[model samples]
Target: MENDTICAISTPIGTGGISIVRMSGSNALAIAFKIFSSKNVSQESIKPRYFYLGNIHTADVNEKCMMVYFKAPYSYTGEDLVEFQCHGGVLVTQKVLQSLIESGARIAQGGEFTKRAFVNGKLSLDEAEGVIDVINAESESELKASYGLLKGNLHKEVEKLQNIITDILSEINVTFDFPENDDEEVTSADVLEKLTRAQKTLDHIIKTSTTGLKLKTGTKVVIVGKPNVGKSSVMNAMLGTDRAIVTSIQGTTRDVLEETYIYKGVKFNLIDTAGLHDSNDLVESIGINKAKEILKNADIVLFVVDGSQELDNFDKDIIKLLNDKKVIVVVNKCDLKQKINSSILPHAEHMECSALENKGITEIKDKIYNMVIDEKVLSQNVIITNIRHAEALSKSNEIILRVITDLQAGANLELVSLNLQSAWETLGLITGVSGTEEIIANIFSKFCVGK
Candidate 1:
């Protein structure tokens, strides 16, 4: 199966300038040569690193294309590769790909290109996961983190930690074999110190993942306040577009309008909901109910207050609802003479902004980033951005921690060795040195076809 040739459409399936039909395996170039017709270059005459202009004649149509070849080990999949840059029409590309598939090239699965990259030692599990992240990134911050991962930033950190763990395990094994030498040179306290340091490092990485995951996935920011308090206006400013309907009439926005945007390397999902006001209208009531539900799951509540109006009883109700949730008080309509008292809200950070005038929005973004991602955490940070890497690292840490606890509680040396070996195996799974067939399939399934 590893030696089987694979082919698929690399570009998106739609009208565009061009589309790519990619093939990989030992005979990628041969399969491509079978379908291409070029007067200037023959399949046998084409070199390993040349592009030949050609015509792809299918059963129905003739498609103009460019054929490029990459010989084994230097290619993306670490095998002989060929790419057909053909017309962008969906039908034409499919016909060309199908023609190649019929010529001894099997259709590549979703992410098969990258899967081969992993199997052939072109990338680690973390780096492979980053390829997916780069394709799926929705914001600037996410793309930066994904780029870092793809470049092996997270892999280096994980490998370094694994090396430290390996050293500790070696020491443990040496102590177990030579009791007198262990007593003369190193004590159990030395082992405890090493384990404690490793545990702290793991804890730090876990903490960094909290922020990294948020940046990748985005923070759920819900805008809540009384009706006519400019919640929709604020949403418009934050999104830099008017996605939500805004009018002078109260309850103009009777539904939850969500828009995601990037600010200073952080992604936020700004949710503008129906104004938090008592209503009998069924539709408005449904929207209000949804607003409350969204608030429950939100990472931050942007309580937008109408600065030109006095604080009403409903404003107090909103404050009561956010008893435990992270709240950011936004005094909207600050361009007008202020009427609401900021001192009333205790311990909540207040920012004056005019969503209408596009004033002070940057301040709001800055505060959100600071509150969610602490400066201290970023000081010693190498975050596992992918869900798979985080899960694997966490499991490895758990196994090692369990071993340490058992040893501290007077467990046998062999018991500690078993757990230590298990931890190493868990870490190996992250890099595909030890992984199940199902896990590989599951990871690849998330990729775009012909990735």
Candidate 2:
């Protein structure tokens, strides 16, 4: 992927005011000159880092374009780069790109530009991931977290911790040089204290993955219960929009209705499932089966119970079925007064609401927010939100724990040294310093073309 010069339409292919055709590699400027006619600009005559008003002539008509050049080491890929901002008719962009390809620039693979940025040392693996997050971000909180990562907060934190570990390793090495004299003062107590502090830092950062991932990808929450418990209404109330239909008739919703909404900078995938119950009707039974299947993957379940009706065997059976799920029992229609037994029902996270009245909805949102996010993590300056980074951290933690154990057991210094080095190597995987070629390819492949 790295050996070839790459070109692609950097802007969306559509009818607009402008579309950008981007090229990068050692031959970028040469390719730009091949199909472009600009005053005093030749492949060798063009000055680096200059923008020239130009015309991109295909086999037929010419379109006015703005071209910019970046020489090696100063360009996005640390090689040469060129861009043509042309009038954005899908036809015009396609013709211009086709001409450039004919002039010898290869089509860029997905994320090839950003992949080049990663290879050039302008960005780390975390920053590259952040770029994707920023592109995919749907809420203010997700954008903020991803923006922080793009600014290198996560990388800086990990690098700082790595430096500290390196220092500790140096101290351990020093202990071997002075066996009886200087080494004796650097006692087990001192070593244990440093290890304990490092462990605390690692543990705290590891726990942030829970809330961070939720913020990044959004939580999958399913609203489910027996018919007429107002599942759709509750969903509409929470979303503050008429996304799902509300009806007085039983089995009004026969399939899943999904809507996405943002709250407190976090995205929520709100799924309203058909009311669950045994039924003779084939369509309702299919819906019921789908509801059951969705629950298996939901991060949270809002199990609605009718407060206006007496507790029945069907309701009890639904509650029993959801006993192991992360359920927030919602007692709906509080305006009618409570008839359902609050005591005999199994205690879980509970909320009261009248979806029709919009009462207690704010409290429900707050409770849901608190149930999922850790306040301490949100306040912290850094977090690990990527599964790959999280996996590397987990491996690094295990190796660190092994090092600590070896130290405490009075194992040979060589054994302890080996474990500590292994921990350091594991940490390197997060930044791609020691990662495999296959892993790099996999990560970059997630990016969109011309990114």
Q: Which structure among the candidates has the greatest TM-score? A: 2
Question: Model 2 scores what on Cα lDDT?
Answer: 0.83
Candidate 1 per-residue lDDT, tens place, 89-112, comes to: 999988988898788999988999
Query: With candidate 1 superimposed using the best TM-score fit, by how many Å does residue 135's alpha carbon deviate from the native?
Result: 1.9
Which regions of candidate 2 are displaced past 4 Å? 40-45, 171-190, 341-344
Query: What TM-score goes with each of the models?
Result: 0.91, 0.94
Clashes of 1: 0
Report lDDT per candidate: 0.83, 0.83
What is the per-residue lDDT of model 2 for residues 316-365, given as tens digits with 9 covering 90 to 100? 77877776778888899999978975643465788889999999888878
